[model samples]
Target: MKKNLLMLFTLFIALFTITSVKADDKPVKNNYRIASDSLFAPFEFQNSEKKYVGIDVDLLNAIAKTEKFNISMDFVGFQTAVDQTQAGHADGMIAGMSITDERKNVFDFSDPYFTANATIAVKKGTKNITSYKSLKDKTVGVKNGTASQEFITKNKDKYGYKVKVFDAADTMYASLGTGSIDAFMDDEPVVKYAILQGQKFETPIKPEKIGEYGFAVKKGTNPELISMFNAGLAKIKANGKYDKIVAKYMGNEASDDKKVDESTMIGIIKNNWEQLASGLGYTIALTLISFVLALIVGIIFGLFSVSPSKFLRGFTKVYVDLVRGVPLMVLAIFIFYGIPNLIESITGHTSPLNDFAAGVIALTLNASAYIAEIVRGGVNSVPTGQMEASRSLGVSYVKTMQRVILPQAVKITIPSLVNQFIISLKDTTIISAIGLIELLQTGKIIVARNFQSFKVYGLIAIIYLIVILALTIFARRLERNMK
Candidate 1:
């Protein structure tokens, strides 16, 4: 237990030292890491060639070219873009974000780049909902962290409607199609784009101007970036480039050519093989790294739980209980967003932890607690007589534990550990909330592009099933070998 604690302490210190060293390396000037929404069409979504090219993407690139500033855009989802920008992992963001007064507390905004309204959309041929009062008792959907969500939530009680929030626009649109939601509110352009793409939806109520969209950076950081964006935006609008860019995406002729026949399952698979393969790779890699770390930390804590010292056992108990009590999604968000904000508040410097590191740490913390209990149960299953016999032979307690106890405990725990690994792998889906593009998130991205929810999600499910079955077979074979 002491050695384990020492090793854990050393690991943390090493991480901190590395972070400090990197902090001293100055960031390149005028070269910014910009974050944008992955699935927000017209603003930002993939083209037919699988290249990211939307109004926001093209506009930002034009702005960068005009300003002579280098920029790299990360097409994570909207909520993730916000989180990344706030955490300083991204230098700025331009995700059709509304310039709400509330946001002014955290982000400094550029001049309004575009104007749009939020409208209530219902399925075609549904004549009932003409106003807010007409939506009484009906469920309405909104994407998370959007102006539409804020409006829906704030007026939900007054309108006597229930609200369902989705993580992405594609899912919310699907819900409306399936009647899971009677209606939904979203940006006018996005709803129109969906209609253009063959979605059977209509806007009944007059659209409300939610707010103008603006480019933003964390408050008090990168003032020059905002200045440059504003200056370049003015130039583009003056030179007629802004109107042309918007027309390219939203014009009457704007439509993606079908790269493949996505109607059939085989076609869907053929079209999306690269994305599916990449997502699966990320999922497997995250699972492998997290499980290994969890195994080490869990065994340490498990040993601590069984230690003779009351303090050690009590500390382990508290840790296991606390971590186990929190939900995985909540833990992930806290680790990714809350921790960085907390660090910045205290030390006045941004924490360098990105989504991947935060996700691994969250998964490791959650899995280790359950694994500690598994270890404790396995150790307790061994007979007390073995330890007594070893001690009677003049063996030290630590040596006896090393030579007799742990080996037997490991054998007993092997099955449970294998099961835990499988659970951890599935749990990686929850990490998508933190914006780590694991298997499920990858599916969401593809669905955002093709709107083939059934085929894409079905393919993802099959992939997961195959991987889990393989792992299960391997585990069974290992158990047979051990026997």
Candidate 2:
């Protein structure tokens, strides 16, 4: 009996020791907030489904999983992401940052998980230089303020290349395609993606080692987090998962000189745009819905602005003063991001607001303030004789305005309404801040894919110019008809 008791006590102690050891080895949950810009595709972007799904995002998730931590992401702008980390809004930035001395002073860096190779992409069926040494007097495009830009400028005498710098890689690539520039330099993946996609005019050759890309932790961030992330990255690389994800997006053979066709690319894009044309239904739908709401709100306040009663007059003035005083950007941010969060806290229901709803609400709220002024002007423009004539006929005050004053106001309001409607249409772009995909959003999506600000967004600007011009013509015709 004594021997059996000793054996049982040993078994229990051993089991408890093993369990404690396993628990201690497991990582703690992350529970950290993060932010990044919505560019850097195949790495970090808000996809069509509005989810942040990309290679960088995936790697970050893997790290969090390995480190036993949780992180929620804020899809802010890239410049904003950098600022946020510097200002301590986020703990770190994992947005395909390269460790440069200029950036290194303010931010600490993890080990380079990846290095971006440099390449010169040029138009199709063109071979000017047989060797790197043969290159001289070539006009090249490099992204502004990048190392490559500096390289091109500094070595202009050495390489004999005249460099044209642009704010975006996409525009730089597009210029290469259009022959606006002879050669372009950019990160390997971005250049390759453009080549594969239809900017086929340019192809990367010689795939030279350019710069190192790493994750950035803010200056003075927790060193333990950096160590854990570095370990997690190593594990992924060793396990073959890292290579798979890279191959899936960037292609298996980096050196394979794939040529893209012009016709096929255009056709594929046209087909996609045909589908995207249906997306305009949502755009128009929101515009019309919001226009009506704004019109109603405007007319109510407009009447109150011109009200005979002092209480009603003062109330309208206060409302006008408040909404007009607040910036549209601030209001949209508050309505879309702030209001929902407030509601969630109070009700304990994380009510998800649809992007369209938030955008429409913002547009309406903004337009109504302007519309009220337009309406008040229209109402005041009506002859006092007209109101008196209706009143003399024993009609009520409401009836006098509806039957006599408003009819005349309609003719004058027509021009103002058209202008107001145009303003509302354009202002919907601001809702992109809260994740709404309007026309500007569509342009940004294209810009992200192609990195061509000129060809991509410039084309969008042309489309807008044509659209607004057509609306102006229509408005003028309507005014003439009314006159």
Candidate 3:
């Protein structure tokens, strides 16, 4: 009986030791936040179901599972992802980012998972260049911060050509198609994908300059995360999962044999209706909020501009001049991206505002400046005799301005106010530069996915035209009634 008890106790101790060892060996399984681009197709992009699913996305998810870590992916734009990651706001990023020596200073990279090659292409029927000499005096388009851009800049003197950089692939392609550029360089896979989708570009040169893509993290941070990614990538490659992912997106071969449909425009609308509708709804919401806010701000500043106190008038003038001096796009960037950095520097705490709120703030400040001028002009347009006559009738200065001046000024400014509203409505597109996904940004996303720039953009333009036309007619009717 003593031997039996001793044996049982030994077994329990051995089991506990084994369990503790296994637990220690396992990863902590903490959640990590990753950022990626929204429109980098086959690598990372939103599908028709509005879900992000592509090569980078799938690979990261598989790695997360294998490494026993949780992940949250943010499909922001490429620049935003890079900025956030460098700012320590994100754990890591994988946006088809090409590894380069310059980037190595700021980001540590995992093993190269993708080897991309680039080719030069031009619009169909354009002259094809066979040698560097043939590219003399030509302008080529390249995406900003891309390997192709670096290549072009390196060889521009040799080729005697000028380079124009574009922010998005679609924009570069558009510039080429529109004849603004003689030729453009892009990754072979992307150009092939665009060709498969019926984009009218012809590859005239052999592929050159291979680029290696790797997952990245801020320099000197997240070493464990990098190790997990490398290990998981190796495992996937060994297990055939990597090949399967590549085949799923790129297919076994690049082919332009897909049928082009006559009803493609209708099909695009049918497929992207939800995106368009949501974008339009947001546009309208932003416009209304901005206009109302601007109206209030304009009135307050307008009163200040015409106040009896010279200091108030001078203060209002300075504010108006400062705000109006900046372009809407510049203001949007300052409000969205700049302010957070400023606050972070001052307080050592990051305070980031959502894109929508920042956009509204920018538009309000911009519109307020114009509206203040409109209001001041309207008030001045009102006769000085009216104010004097009201004052002689025992009305206080405030009462005279409120009862006599404002009412007439509002009436006089109605047409101009409506026009300003129209201008504000159009200016909402500027917010897209900061990634608001307004109507224009939504259209760009759809174009990125479908490679149907003309169809999608034409649809968006039509929608805008119709809305503006209706507003113009309504404004005309309102003006006639006032008359």
What is the number of backbone collisions in each predicted candidate, taken in the order shown? 0, 8, 0
Give the per-residue lDDT digits (tens) of candidate 3, residues 372-395. Answer: 999999999999999999999999
With a 3 Å backbone cut-off (N, CA, C), the pairs that clash in candidate 1 are none
Query: Global CA lDDT of candidate 2, please?
Result: 0.70
Ranked candidates, highest lDDT first: 1, 3, 2
Query: What is the overall TM-score of model 1 with all chains considered together?
Result: 0.90
Over 292-410, each residue of candidate 1 has an lDDT whose tens digit, in order, gives: 99999999999999889999999999999999999999999999889888988899988757788988999999999999999999889999999999999999989988999999998
What's the lDDT of the predicted structure labeled candidate 1?
0.89
> Could you give candidate 2's per-residue lDDT for residues 57-130 as a string of tens digits?
88888887887777887655555466556655566777666678888899888888888776777777777854
Counting only residues 3 or more apart in sequence or on different chains, how many pairs clash (N, Cα, C under 3 Å) in candidate 3?
Answer: 0
Q: Would you estimate the TM-scores of all the predictions?
A: 0.90, 0.61, 0.88
Off-target runs (Cα >4 Å) in candidate 2 are 1-38, 45-54, 57-235, 247-271, 340-352, 392-394, 465-483
Best by TM-score: 1
Candidate 3 similarity to native, TM-score? 0.88
Please, what is the whole-model Cα lDDT of each candidate in the order they appear? Answer: 0.89, 0.70, 0.84
In candidate 2, where is summed lDDT lowest over 10 consecutive residues?
A: 254-263
Residue 12 lDDT (model 2): 94
Which parts of model 3 have CA positions greater than 4 angstroms off?
A: 1-31, 48-50, 87-90, 124-127, 220-224, 253-263
